[model samples]
Target: MSNIIQRIEAFSQLGQFLSQFTTERISKKEQVLHNDLFFDAFKMQVERAQEFNGWFTLDNVLFSCEGWSKSLTNENLNKFIDSINIKKNTPKTIAIIMAGNIPLVGFHDFLSVLLMGNSVVVKQSSNDKHLLPILAKYLEYIEPSLKGQITFTEEKLENFDAVIATGSNNTARYFDYYFGKYPSIIRKNRNSIAILTGNETDDELNGLADDIFRYFGLGCRSVSKLFIPKGYNFDKLFNAVFKYKDIINNAKYANNYDYNKAVYLMSLFDLLENGFLMLKEDTSYASPIASLFYEYYDDSNSLKEKINSDKEKIQCVVGNGFIDNEIAFGQTQLPTLLDFADGVNTLEFLNNL
Candidate 1:
């Protein structure tokens, strides 16, 4: 327990250190541990992260860090841990196969494993191989006990007692076949959606813009689809979301937009566009970059039933007074520590294992 408390303190300190870098800029503060050692190095890591992954823009990387900084507060950490019972004190090596779609996407799993007195062998996606390793180094420096507890490998996993793997639907099958012998949590592709009632305030629509535009709609929590009322006027939605038009300036995003738009044009699919984002009437939950799929619903109950039936494919529902436990608009990316992926209580899973 004393060791766990020390680990918590070390993570909190890391939060404080991460707070220095925001979407605005990266600034060093004096009280952060090993500032002289890690501050500049982390900045270089951020730059290299973008160079390595085209989706990892500086703004997105800093935004991810900022969210982590806020989530790693002592109060939040305690609250998250308090909900679970940690009885597995004997350390077991847990293998984590992470997704590369977003920055530090696997940190929550990593933290969960470490906080539960387990070792982690992380198999990071090649696209997101930069940030978390450095942060792990920082954690090891702050808490020397964590040095051997955490390991990264590019090769096939071995000698791990349990597994946490995240990937698309196809890779999930692979994970199931390979890691089925172990206690495991394998996640499949899931996307988020929004429900619009035509009565939403402009502020709410604008907030939805953040949910859609953040991370370029690559995250599972990003709003990739919308369920709007029949005959809804899209002018207001377009007007509100247009504030994020600057996103098209990104070369990668623009290329995707052009490619998807050309494909849609060739296929004769109807699309609504405002120069940056395109909206298509599609039934699929996952939308390509720079595009969102929307479906018109006749009533809320039927829509609710449909959503509930397809819950496995959905990550979150963002709306106003639409669904129970729905995420508020613009807040999908700012998940609290307790917001475990796939609604599986990660801490509890680790604790019981």
Candidate 2:
């Protein structure tokens, strides 16, 4: 019991350490010098969080880890070191296919590999390759230990023990076929949701927009759907979001919104066809197109039935207004220090291997 207490303490300290990494390693001004991919990703994260003035809060960072670690057991912790597989000594490589959305989507995968005690071979997302390394300077301050383990590459993957790839439903098939034989985890298209009690004031409703639109609706963990009590009028919801119109006012978002809205309207008349879609709502948690943030539903009696029915499609649910065991979208995966793949808890798996 005392050992468990100490282990928990270590995680708490590690959480604090990592929180500082987000704030200290990342900079707003120096962000301009990053690759364009990271520049836009960071901008979206900062601006949407309304922390544009503050960058990332150490509090949020620690909160994310705490949220993720809720399910870890003392038994799991005891076996963590045994579950991870790493080649001993120099140049042992692990391949990772990173997510493009959100700031430092790659960082999740990078952190997994680092914590698992392996060298990383990263396939930087072409869409987001521009901005993630802004932390190279900050990481230098926090952990000189990482300086040796990190390596970037565009080269063909070769000579690696494990591969971790994240992509859409389509790309996942290819990942399964090509990377299947090797030890791997291939992530498919996942959508997140939020359960609403409809008790929120205008202020909380508006804040919900941050969970929905923080990364321009690109993150897998962002609220992708909403479930609400019956007969909830959208007027109140729209009023809340309308307050954040300044964000929609941004040229890029406005253009995308207009483009998606046009496609949606056109689709109503069967006038246009292509890679476009628009979803309607009284108060949805989902955005349309390449990403979904949130959605709303009125069915109460059948709520759990509906969710369980679509369980295969739904990846995570952010149940607001719930107590005790309520978990959010980002918290779906119980990540340990070594759950290096698609949020799988690898330490437990490799320990037996």
Candidate 3:
């Protein structure tokens, strides 16, 4: 059996391997173990992922790789591991149902299960099926004892003690019905929001633009709605976010922008647009692609109370000390290992199981 030290070292090495594929460039380093065998293969997989899923552009995939590389360091992994208690018991198999909204979105769950000395059976989203398997192969190569511990399947899952599933609200209902008897963590629809005061500087607003536009605003961590002062100026935000105006060049994104704009205009709805993005006054949390929704808040106390009331529907609150547990302006998409989704402690759940 592989001990905790070996597991952590293997993951740390995997992090080192991922460091080569950042958004700046994909350079090969001779120091990386097995690079002669795996580097070119992984690079091809990245390109293949972009070709298969239109939303998975090459740069966005590299950005995801960059975030994971920064997160999977020796210091960070050790800190996360030391925070939890691992028992010496027989290992069990954990089933993971992943979401494909962004590249490698479900990797944290996969890492949690394996690091806790449990085997994993993963059912990947078709939209993201190309990347993780190759990485898993690399892990097995680095740690031979990890063989036979990981499995990927397309068939119905069976013989698993617990499950971690993420999907939309409708699929969550089915997962609840099927996996209810087992110890499970079932995640449903959730969106992130931002609270803006008129006092934001240009740099902070630019970071806010990243929170809204990265991954084309598809991830749950992406800010889809805003709570602003009653008489806020939109010009500051528009000017800051104009740096991302090139996003309109992507055909899929442009199609959504044009279609949604047409619908809003035909319905005679009031809107503010700057040719690339649109701002609509909506109370809903989930906004369409290329559109942002905003609401007016009269007082901070009432806004905080309302947010607390709707905490379950919210994933991140990007602000500058406006509330407890708020994320900084541009840090939503660059979550660390400890930033568990839905505010649930995945390691704690695995430990108890």
- Top of the candidates by lDDT: 3
Worst window of 10 by summed lDDT in candidate 2: 269-278
- The per-residue C-alpha lDDT of model 3 at residue 100 equals 94
Q: Is 1 or 2 the stronger prediction by TM-score?
A: 1
Overall local distance difference test of candidate 3:
0.93
lDDT of candidate 2 vs native? 0.52
Which digits, one per residue and each the tens of the lDDT, describe model 2 over residues 146-257?
Answer: 5655666788877787787888889999999989888877788766676777677665676565566555556666566767666656566566555445555455556776
Q: If scored against the real structure, what TM-score would every candidate get?
A: 0.98, 0.64, 0.99
Sort by TM-score, best first.
Answer: 3, 1, 2
Model 3, 1-353: lDDT tens digits are 58778888888889999999999999998889999889999999897776888899999999998899998888999899888876666788999999998999999999988888899999999989999998899989999989999999999999999999999999999999999999999999899999999999898999999999999999999999999998899999999999999999988899999999999999999999999899999999999999999999999999999999999999999999899999999899999899999999999988887
lDDT of 1: 0.91
Residue 220 displacement in candidate 1 (angstroms)? 0.4
lDDT of each: 0.91, 0.52, 0.93
